[model samples]
Target: MDASELLEVLSPEGLRLLDSLPPWRASDDVVSSVAALRRQGHPPERVSAVLTQARLRARAEAKFGEFASRMLFTEAGLEQATRLNVAARHADRYRSAGLTSVADLGCGIGGDALAFAALDLDVLAVDRDEVTAAIASYNLSPWPSSRVRQGDAETADLTDVQGVFLDPARRTSGHSATKRIADPADWSPSLEVAFGYAERLPTGVKLGPGVDRDLLPRDAECQWISVDRDVVEAGVWFGPLARAGVGRSALVISASGAAELTAPADSEDVEVGDLGEWIYEPDGAVIRARLIGDLARSIDARTISRDIAWLSSDERVETPFAQGFRVLETLPLDERTLKRELRSRGIGRLEIKKRGVDVDPATFRKRLSLQGSGSATLVLTRVAGRHTALLCERA
Candidate 1:
């Protein structure tokens, strides 16, 4: 949103209207809602701003929880902002390292800055966008230890700052709707410059999970983070914030809690064995961090293929790093044989999983003419360099 729209939303009249409105639901009637707000004598700008905040608040709750309600957000800022819970963990590194103040360059909406301040650390939160920096100032108003600025991150003077948190804008340059900028160098402030900062001072750089491993600095601690099974962010830590002797780390965060694994480097030298009684699908974070071998060793499992990430073991493995499923039996990969086998076994519902070999599950499912009452999990992958299918159940 523009500065004018934001100013109106933060106004007393606008806030009262926003607070008075009922909670926003995804299925709410948009036309009726707008009509009702107009009937209350609110101007179109104020009404629109208030309604937008209300709707954004609902969506932001997933990331910021209750704090989202009190915070103002621009659409792009909210979309790009690090989840508050994840930001807290990032803040802890600075606190634990005895760093007193941090400069969060490119701090969209102050998500990480808020966490830092909450943990009793000082913050210099800066953003290049005018309205975003303003919103960040508003969000961080409760903390006297924090300051917000509108400026280019590369030009920020952090001489007095103890630590640095750089989240270069990965979207196209603008205060408007964002589109992903594909080139890593095209990222605002540049990844090259970010790594330069890493080499010079205590720093953390946030990047996409798919960033080329070869591009990662050799000395920094690269971390892959996954929330609810989806790989979300990869952060590289430098200086004291960097974990000792750890070159790579995977952090999995879910409602259950957070679990982490660290190693000096990624490797997949473990033996690939024949398919066993149970199958384990490693979490995306684990795979991305190249810790599947580590996880396999932890669970006493072996890989189904040297190149594949899937793990298998005869005994049950109850680790958060991977999902374990018990195999029922092997199935034919061929269409005619698979269809005949499914019909004979009376399996109507199927959960299809695939890896290594790329036979479309949807098309394969459609071709399977079934006449059965039982439900089954079908795994399609390569075993001993041959296309193989295994029917399994959740362990």
Candidate 2:
């Protein structure tokens, strides 16, 4: 939204309307609500702005939790902002490193800046977009340690700051339509420039988890982060922020809490062996960090195939880093043979899971016809470089 529209929304009457609204649910009738508001003599602009804010707040709940109600967001800015829980962890690094002040370059909608300021660190939150910067200023107004400015991050004077945190814009500009910029060189304040900041001060930069591994800096501590089962971001920490001796790490955050697997150096390859009684699917963060071998060793398991990531062992093993499944039986890879075997076993419901293969699970599921009451999981993968299927249940 434009500055004027945001101003109207931030006015006293607009805030009251936004505050009075109930938790929006799918059952709410939007057309009727707008009609009711119009009948009450509310201007269309204020109603439009209030409705937009309410909708954005509902969506933002997944990232900011309860704080979303009081925050302002642009469509693109909210999408690009880091989750508040993750931002708090990032803030801890600054506090732990003895860094008292930080330059939050490219700080969009003040997500990280809010966390940093909450920790009592001096934060200079910078964003080039005027509306976003203004919103960030509003969000951070409660903290005396926080400041927001509208300026190019690349040219921002940061001589007084002890460290820098840059979350580069990785997409095309706009609230309605944004194109993902695939090339790291195309990111605002390009990787080449951001990578150089570590030479002068401690630095941390966030990138897409699938960012080219070849582009990672050797001197930084690169970490892949996963929230629940979804891999969300990859970050590189330089200088003291880089955990000592650790070159790569996988950090998993779930409802239970957080767990990490770290490697002082690149993981070594483990020998492949035949499937035993159990199969282990390592977390995505572990796989992205290239630390699957470490996870395999910890579980006393061997790779199911040289080219595949699935690990196998003789007993049930459940660890924080991977999901364990008990092997019920092995199945034929052939479609007709598989159908016959499944039908004989009275399996009607199936959960198809595949790795290291091109077959689409949903498409294959549609082809199966059976009459049974049992539910089963089918693992489609390579074994000894040969295609195979294994039927199993959760361990």
* Highest lDDT scorer: 2
Worst 10 residues of 1 by lDDT: 169-178
CA lDDT for candidate 2: 0.89
Candidate 1 wrong stretches, greater than 4 Å: 174-177, 343-348, 369-374
TM-score of each: 0.95, 0.96
What is the per-residue lDDT of model 1 for residues 189-235, given as tens digits with 9 covering 90 to 100? 89998888876679999998988888898888999999999888999
Q: Every model's Cα RMSD, please? A: 1.8, 1.5
Which has the greatest TM-score?
Answer: 2
Superposed on all Cα atoms, model 2 deviates from the true structure by an RMSD in Å of 1.5
Whole-model alpha-carbon lDDT for candidate 1: 0.89
Question: Pairing residues by index, what is the TM-score of model 2?
Answer: 0.96
